[model samples]
Target: MAMRRFGVAIVLSVILMAAFAAGLSAAKRGISVGEWLSVPFSDASFAKRWGYGETNGARNVISADRAQQRNGKPTLRLDTNSGFDCWVYFPNTKDWDIDLSKAKVMRGYLRSENKNGWGGDPWIIFVDMAGRKARFDGLKQRLYDAINDWTEIVVPVGADLDAKCAEYGWKAQISPGFDWKHISCVQIHQDTDGSGYTMWYSGFEFIDYAGRTIKWWLSSINKPDLSVTYAEQVPQYKRYIASEPDPNYNIPELVGSAATEKHWPNEGEQIKYLVHIKNAGFARSKPTDFVCMIDGKVVKKASLPALAPHQVTTIVVNWKWKQGPYQFAASVDTKNKLDEITKKNNTLRFKTDAYVLVAVCEKSIVAPIEQVNNWYGSFCFEDWMRGATIDQLNSLFKRCKYDFAPNGAEVSVRLGKIFLVDELPDDGAKIGEIDKGLGLYIFDGVWHYPLRAIHEWCDLANDFDWALNHELSHQLGIIDDYQYDMGPDSNLVNHKAYDRGPGGIMGGGQVGDNVYPAYADVDIAGFNLTKGHRRGFFGEYLYCIPYKNTLVLSIDGRPLADKDIEIYQKSMYTGKIEAPPVFTGKTDAEGRFPLANRPVPKDFTTATGCTLHANPWGYPDVVGRNGLFLIRTQVDGKWYYGFIDIGRFVCEYARGHKDNAVYSVKLMPE
Candidate 1:
């Protein structure tokens, strides 16, 4: 009996190995018994669902035929005669729209009719209802390496779809609206020279991954960890800040009044407090309760849905704008409904005032004041800032983690009043200064510059709003994280790849958005009303912003006043100093060589109007080395030397700690 059982087991093992040898491994192919949505070209009705188009006047014939079917299944055939390109598309029609949110892969079988194989590359594209498209190309060699027989071509359509497509040159506009919920269309392009070729395709299907079992180890000791990450107040009202007459405000009878009235939100305005809850655990969490309180009174109570591991959801609690200040608190699973990894972060508390007053510098002693008092037309800076800049600021603070590590506070600056003022406290009347106690932002003129370079030809703009946010952050106790000086360090090896720091608004205006994380130790920080005035927090300049630097040159305690200095930098490729100077300029009366506010050199400008400042620092096309420039000046037939390294953000070696740093050297006769 034992011998007979062993013989049967051997026969079963042989059959299983034989099946695997015939390419029947489900795990290898990511295939499972499931609901598969397919586009089988079994009949002529497929032509109705699919449309064909040509580019470069290409001639092509596409049809469904049973003659060249794969495994007795009808196949779609494409014959290319004479053109640069041709394509077949499943249009964005009502009948073809598919919900691919749960899908894992879109795969098909393809074969070439010619013995030597086809000469063109094949590509597939998926378009969402929002008109956003994701295209994947270079499949000629990838999918059909040797395709006299049917070859399998797989493209991931799940969460990793974009990443999979990106491996093979994906071209797509990524928008928040471009999601998998409604995939409207699918396209296949044949990119070839006007050569005659034929190809057949069959078994195009979308495989789902939802029902697939994910193997995860479970331990009785492990528990779900739920935490309230952060919270913020979102005001739901319209405000405008404009320095020009309202062009769209037309009330024919009250046109005069409409133009002058700054649209500020009034009392009793609706505001939503958003609480972010995260399941920061290895296991999924059960459905739980969320509670929100305002000034110790329960304002909202709602049930939260069950959350997967690491999933986060924001619960919104509505409130009306009341007079004075209010304290806010939120908690998840308040009743200890489920065991969690930790309960320390399950609740959060913060405070904010009902409204904040913003005083504008209408009359500046430094610059001319432009004001239009009449209702017919007026330069309304208040409305313009309220409408655009403040909204942008609030959006940034909603994501800001200030005064705390990891989970920062989100505070809102609700505009209470917009009044003109001639002066601000503590010299805040100076341009770019802001008094947080008074919400006063001193504006001199248009503040505009390139915050960062998106590419060689394009730069991201940092205008009035950027300067405002940076200054406002200072008032909120956020200290400048940028190094402000250039001190000598014998051991400091300035390399482009080595110089890296935490980049954000505090780090010398290196970011495009104000939502970058920052830290502050002052008592009154973020958008909170728990305030006691702390002096010397605002109006301070960053030690070094990107592309700008200031250096004081002196010798033997005497300034190198009005002297010509040459700037020479080492070649990144050769590691040798270039003979001809990159820039030569005269020092100021105080021997200050201010490299700030200097425009890109004409030599660095291309005919295409792109700046050659594409390297990490503002230097031209240096490959590896940091932008270290040597300042050389001749005095009494002797040369004095000093160095400044500009590589992305300033390194620890270059940090001099002084706002105005000095570099002094005595020229020696050799």
Candidate 2:
């Protein structure tokens, strides 16, 4: 019903183990001082201990179907339409007394079914000697602003009761000199007067004052995100059924599993929005105010009338913001304006873009458009679009779907038309309308955009498509996976935490080779799909080449020039080598080679081992005893062929996939 479902096994097992270790006194884990009674409303034996009946005693429950459940488990359900029903534990009979002196707070899980019943005044009254009652009225406002979601109730009793609550013990309506000791009964009453509502419940117990607080020591995995799998939630599923003991719970229940739809907007264009806010609780929502925020700023505010349980309503908000991706959030009463339970699930988030198409006709690529077409599969369109004609982009974009890479970012950009000089565009004003100028007007390198990519000489740079999508990715909010100079631990793109190596389009060298998006990227795009983690070595290196990190070379102090970086495998003992460059690529800016996992090794291994999944390739971090080396410069260029543990290098430099790390290497000049 909230952010994440817990691993029932871990929680249940831990409790069960603790109970066993504590030498549970044959009382179902009930401890001394206070007991967390498992009064399952469905368990006839337990219900008999604390009898259930209506206020009139004659009102008989027609059927058990009225009993509600969450995620399909039996829960406490009160249908106010039947009449004002009050149930008490250890009633006025005084046969069983609960000592509130030490066993302090009374807690229970509460939620309403009929949202319209929100205004219902629910109370927890503690009855002691002289038939005097001390009502825990502190929950009055909370019940009034209730939603149809489960929330834990912690009301003080006995010494834990504050001065104001103790004063209620001396009121006229209640007998004076109310005593906490020999407390006869505790009653849960809701008077909706036939306004008909429902509140599902679970785990009602009385424990020491120390247990009054609700502690949430949870992991991010328990919080469930786009990357979480159903298999990981098996323990939670099993635990629900065991605790709730509902046959229906045998089938899995889903919550907040809906994917978001992209809302494409235009730059500086005002638009009306109909945002929906849902009440996931049973009692009627006390008068509510809905607030909508965009990019952290409150863009719209509106008041909502009382809403029924599980009801939803839409509010209109006007927005006219600048281009790029936008993060939209709608919160139900962020302020403490309503008396409600938990504020956990009151807010929802969405992602969208405001796109524009523009052209840079400074100098068209000499090669055919086919080369650029291949980049689309590799996802370099954002980096290879520089100096392209508007017509060429039109053809390519027509086949493309709207997507953002580097996975998570809040920005959007539209491809606007770039006008040709004299014809309709220039640095100056023109008759035609151009919303914004794509200032990619200057570049000196020769680009043909052809399949047979050319090299300046013997050194070939992996500069293909870098100027286009690569440059634009920055504007779109995705950072380079390669950090210029950060340490391995601080590498944002490929850190130890990153298990999805060589699988995302956001990565540098390696990403360039594969030109792909990791599963996280797909999720960020709101696509319910997984391509599985792409696994393979760049050659015999046992992993994707130097892709996640950038290597800048300096020969005897200056940027090394006219040298190519070659990687190959060598024997640890014999120093024997495999001929041919496992990978061959030159550098840019004299000696900087930004790599990508490219030429996508033709012979991808089918033997499985690397990850939790049966991946065909070994783990990126495990490169075995076989030594792997990198040649700083080749062919009489002065640098000698040396073996460097590429795996250890990856462990060090290829850390984060969110930022670039430039590792500078100093070599002797030829």
Candidate 3:
């Protein structure tokens, strides 16, 4: 029976060896397995039986174990004298050459166990003998909880890795082809607190990582092949794919004021219109291939190096009409349709009807002073009118006549009394008055008053030119040089010299005192013109008017008592409607009421005109009775109010009124 059992065992052994040989023969060709480094620990054995120590080199030293008894376990126990410290050498004793060019990812598993080393964090270092030492610093510290267990860590070999390696003092000479040949040392460390720690480690492997490519293959069996390569294609021919739509591309919408069919500009006049192009989208729009066309003829093209999304660009385009009243449109190419079916890639369009009248260059003529008053007082009036050439004003009227006309009917002004008898107090009430009008208030007591008074009294015409020009500019939507005082001694010279630099309109006349105007002041005036209304008046009332057809007083569009409305009517019945009718009325609660219904007496009608007057109660200083005559007029089919000779009224009243004493006036027609 023993001989028969021995025979069966021999036969089974031979069969097993034969099967292994056949499996080896069928294996694919590759580098054969050789002596590779073995992991130092398998389970918990390293911490249970081994004793540890430390070396003077700051390395953890493990007491040597008997080679035969310990097997392949780490024979050296790391020392814990100064808390935790340990090191392991990945000896270069085998033919374990890694083909870095073919490897996709490098990975390993590591841990430590010394009780002290286990609690504190430790890092595993990979060193290359053929190159320099590369430190993957803080990598282990980040995985605090991940250290205890056998944790797998991987690193991809790409430009990012190359850049990182170079940044960390690694020798730059090593190219991407360099191999990770050796791990010179592995160590464990503890925090300054000296808490003991221990850990164990095992598995290490290199994975053939193929990220999205593998994911795609796994997701779809019929995925398109990505092996084909292409070179040199024009932008038009190439599939233009933008991560986002061009910001400059705008969808059609109403901006600023609503457009009305009747108010549209004439086709020829609309040829050149300014419109703002804003980037209302989320991405930048490159304007490399943009072109602007009018009536199918190219007028302007833009190459906006880059128009960031949400940024605004102002454009002036010609709106030409090809013999019809059809609307003109602006378009932009989004360059995005091929990749995704989206409206963003399509050309965006904005359309508006052409103008109604053709623009012609007409010679500049001085705007009638009356027309100037009306234009300045209108709520819709622009600051440009203060310095506009007559031609420009006419052109503006011709272009926006309808809009401007209605706004003119609502024109009004706020007047404050300036006392020349005594020094002005800087009380809140005076401050409030100045604040309301943002105008100058001159008193006669300042040391420089004599010089200022000479300019005011002798240069009446010049005063009209400078004072009226400056003050009216304020009423006309121009800004003040708030930096100047409204004292009696103030003159153009004082204004200019006060600042000791270049004098502006607010600086008075001395510094840049070329009687006409300073270049900076003129530039400011021009800017005010071009920019429309002043920035300061955005929320404030442009003008105040008595309600139409109501014989009541009004202030800032609100009704007040009759006493609050002051009227001044000119003497002449020139029959010239273009002139601002000499009419001024204060308001009462019910609304502004006509102060007089009768015509001016023949005696009061001077070579120029008749006069009318009215004044608010409580503001006795602003007496209305001093004026010579009252006049009546019709506007928009309603009886309007006016004061005939405001210049003469102011002059006479300034001379007669006592200092600090208030006076009142009323205009009753005969």
- The best candidate by lDDT is 1
> Model 2 over residues 1-670: C-alpha lDDT tens digits?
1011121211221222256433543352132122223333222212212322333312221112234555565554433343444433322123224556765566666666554554444567777644577765443444554456676665666674555355333211334688876665566655554444555455666666476432111111111110000000001100011011234211111222211212233356666655555443324566666777888899887787676644556676677844444676666666745433223345544433322333433223212221211111110122223222222322222322323332222222333322233232332453223323323211111112222221110011111232344334433223334321123253222221112245333342232222232212321221111111111111122232233556677665767566777654443333334445555688776777654533322223221111111111122222132323344465463444332334333333223332344566655332
TM-score of 2: 0.27
Overall lDDT per candidate, in order of appearance? 0.45, 0.37, 0.27
Ranking by lDDT: 1, 2, 3
List per-candidate RMSD values in Å: 20.9, 26.9, 33.4
State the TM-score for model 3. 0.20
lDDT of 3 by residue, 1-670 (tens): 0000000111111112245443442342122221121233222222221212222212223333333122354333333334323333322111123333333444544443333323333343433434333334333442355444444445443235565444432222333434554322222223323544333333333334452111000000011111000011011011111121223321111223221112222334434544334333223444533455545556666543345533545455554433332333333432321111111212222222211111111112111111111111110011112222222222222222111132211121111111122322345685445333422211101011122222122112101224433443343333333222222233211111112135434332122323323312322322222231111121011011111113433333444454333333211222112223334554444544543333311111111111221231111111111212233433234443322322222222323321122212222221
Candidate 1 global lDDT: 0.45
lDDT of 1 by residue, 125-199 (tens): 777755566666654463355256787776656477567666634434344567776675677766544365676
Worst 10 residues of 2 by lDDT: 226-235
Model 3 worst lDDT run, 10 consecutive residues:
1-10
Error of 3 at 541 (Å): 90
For lDDT, candidate 2 versus 3, the one ahead is 2
Q: Which numbered prediction scores highest in TM-score against the true structure?
A: 1
